[model samples]
Target: MEGKKKIVIGLLGESGSGKDTVAEYLREKHGAKLMRFADPLKEILHIFFDKISREDQQWLALQLRERFGRDIFPKALKRRIENESGIIVVNGIRFWEDYDFIEGFDPGYVIYVTADQKVRWERSSKRGEKSDDGADFKRFQELEQSETEVHIPEIGEKAGFIIRNEKDLNFLLEETDRIMNEIANK
Candidate 1:
């Protein structure tokens, strides 16, 4: 296990499926390093704008992918992780291309988190992310139809582990702990 990559967990989920919570749990409890496939895009966009919205990010991703290919962000993140070690949680694996690329890592795995739509909307409204504030349920539903979110369910089917995040934070942490144990013991 030492010779191989420690643990590379690709997380896929919709807007409020607790992917961030799971990633944070891994980092806090298991000493995992957290990553997101969109880090490069976020960094670039951040330089130009004080805060980037999800719609803006989706647009940027679409524009870049059209020019550099769909696998561009995943490839960039892979380079970032190349020399790092320890449990690395790559959040935001919404596309099959992201899953395919990350899972190629020697110790890669994916976990998909899901939650009730209404519950997700409620949580998302208050999460206070730059893009999600002022979002109504109607807007949340609309975002689901966007190209960036369309592949989440399909890509989630490919996850090595799938967990539901309901209304309880304790339940989420426990499930995350169990999943991490199972992954590490592999």
Candidate 2:
């Protein structure tokens, strides 16, 4: 596998924009291992609260960044993936520092998955995940103004590949496969 390039793909997008779907696609199709920067925070939160809600996760992440450093999650994720081979898909890249840290690994590709706000809201509502339990248009918009959500648009602008996921699952999978091929060939 000397000629096989090990790709580190950072997925960037708003909530319910299909980032997790794309990560799952990469895992199943390309045998890419899935990693999330919030994992460590989630683990720590689970210790304090039996059930860690999405809001708790976000609050903790912000607090950790403010108290510790902006690069805390990125540093932890880099350490976790340092020895991993083949394709690795990182699902929760929120800050510019996260992007830069992943790119430092070489052969890193950031793919930004996006969809219309209405469509994303619909998808989010239909998914019925605990994170979206009481989510509405106004709440979603409010979340977008948060410290973490504010950075995603800029990250999407700078992503190597941008995929608009407004259509069916097959369409998304096909687009993801095409992007994977393009990255693999690069």
**Alpha-carbon local distance difference test for all models:** 0.84, 0.84
Lowest-sum lDDT 10-residue window in model 2: 125-134
lDDT of 1 by residue, 87-175 (tens): 78899986778999878988789999999888888888887786655599998899888888899998888789999898599999988
Ten-residue stretch with the least lDDT total in model 1: 1-10
Q: What TM-score, to 2 decimals, does candidate 2 have?
A: 0.93
User: Candidate 1's C-alpha lDDT?
Assistant: 0.84
TM-score, structure 1 vs. true: 0.94
TM-score for each candidate, following the candidate numbering: 0.94, 0.93
What are the per-model C-alpha RMSD values against the true structure? 1.7, 1.8
